[model samples]
Target: MDYWKSKVLPKMRLIFVKAGGKKAAAAAELVKSFDESKGEINSEFEEKKADLQPKVVEIYESVTAPVKVLIKERKKVSAIKKNSAAITKLFEDLANIEFPGAKQVSEGISKVGPALLSSPIFATFEKIAKLLPVVVEETPKEAPAATEEKKDEAAAAEEKKEEAADEEKKEEAVEDKKEEAPAAAEEAAPAATAAAEPAAEETSAAPAPEAEPEAAAPAEAESAPATAEETPKAA
Candidate 1:
């Protein structure tokens, strides 16, 4: 960041201030755009930086420094162009992994030649940003199980077996409770029906008094027998 601000940024401002022809004017416009976009570029770079190898980033910085020096010193255009091409080559050679995105950056630099040397570090930063997410990427993978002592292995296996047994027992208990619910409901059904029938019978018989006459007749006969005994005694 310091290098971009101190070294490359000054050069870019100079390119803009010294803008003359059409191409220079366009390049000057590009420098301003690069300056404005640096915040986004830097934020993205920071987020994905952990995946990139530091060696590659240092090498890229090295490549950018010399090109900026050559352009600042007003060295030959051919020398600046050579160093610019080297930036693209450095990334391609340093790429130790296969990835589509990194390949694209290298191919793009090969075709474009890393913009004019006087421009801001826009192309350089962008190339690094694209490569950061892919070059030497560390894919997350499940670690291998560590070796264990025979005693520990046996104990772990026993614990796993115990857990399995406990789970099976819990399942059986749940099934038993489920079965008992229906069985209890069925047992209660007969008692409820039996009690209901008696209630219905009592309700139906409550309004009827047909047995009263029979009860009265038995009492009258007892009275008559007593009367007969008294009459005999009197005679």
Candidate 2:
């Protein structure tokens, strides 16, 4: 029983795992619904595309086709037209044209678009022409670079100013030290001389005081003998 439970239970658990989890069941339901919706939408889109594809492909093919090079190309420039409804009419008119040569067809389309659209067509074409190069490869302006250079120059000028200020402070400190040196030396010299004078006077008088003490003691002894003689005469 123990072996059966241990082995069979594990095998049953593995089977349950193979059946997948609750989250997986929910995800599968969601995917099934999404796939059905996607299939329906795709079929509808394909049917629509089937109707539009031929016309769009024709336009694409005509645009891609090579044109015969003219020996002397016409330097023809169209006048600017300013109209909104005219531009839409021009696109419609160009769509109807089927030209003999590819170059002629392209030229016909360009001319027809400008003529029908008028000013709006010209403005849109100009805008697209300006945008195409910018969209593909951006051209950076030099203003930021010029500003960065100015900032660097300003920083350098400020650093030079700070260095000059530091140099002036150092010069002032040096001058102050120089001015204090003479006063310090003069003040120290008087103190030293005054201390030396006292030492010299004490040394010179020290020997004189010791010699005078011996002379003074004999004078006191002679006076004592005279005083003894005067006492005997009085008795």
Candidate 3:
């Protein structure tokens, strides 16, 4: 009785009172009530059991008497069948036996079996079995949402990477332009110097013409003296 109160009753309670939400709240309330009133409930159950004990024993004897007789007779028969190596024949012989009250016992078991299946306890156990897979299936349902979020994050990262690459390419192009500017200036400098050299040569050659005019005036003066001296020699 103590073991049933402590162990079996809690397990029975848990089958009906699941462990989540409103059910968890109800289970907690049930546990609190059990804790507060366990002594009273146990006393009441004991009184009820005492009241019904005699009838329960009578029913138990009535149900088990035939089973006990069957077991004893089966053992005796099996012992003989084992010596003959004929277990199947023993079962066939037992099936033929129609003890006076056997029909009532078989009918009682058949009625009780269906009643147990239709009971609230069995229904609660079935419900718990059904809920078991729901908890397992919940995690997989959330997985797709997380996977989609990860895919979005990866896409954003890829976009950022592409933007960074484009910026780097633009910077490289600007740097290439900057490097080419100096090379272009250096090339233009030699061309500019080559163009100025022809102008400088033209200016120097113009001054040489003016100096030649001055030399021509000096030559004219020497020629006049030579002609005057030649005329005096002829006289």
Model 3 lDDT per residue over 117-154, tens place: 11221222222222222236457779999999999999
What's model 2's lDDT at 135?
34
Candidate 1 structure quality by residue, lDDT tens digits, 1-235: 9999999999988887675454555555555665676677556556656655465445546565664444235435566456666656654754444222344445544543445523443344344544433445443442222334666798999999999999999999999999999999999999999999999999988966579889999999999999988997887
TM-score each candidate.
Answer: 0.27, 0.31, 0.31
Off by over 4 Å in 2: 1-140, 208-235
User: Model 1 TM-score?
Assistant: 0.27
Scored by CA lDDT, what does every candidate get? Answer: 0.60, 0.49, 0.48
On TM-score, who's better, 1 or 3?
3
Q: For every model in order, what is the number of clashing pairs?
A: 0, 6, 0
lDDT of 2 by residue, 96-130 (tens): 54211222223333434333222232322332222
Worst 10 residues of 3 by lDDT: 114-123
What TM-score, to 2 decimals, does candidate 3 have? 0.31
As for candidate 2, its clashing pairs are: 81-118, 81-119, 82-119, 86-116, 86-117, 87-117
Error of 2 at 49 (Å): 40
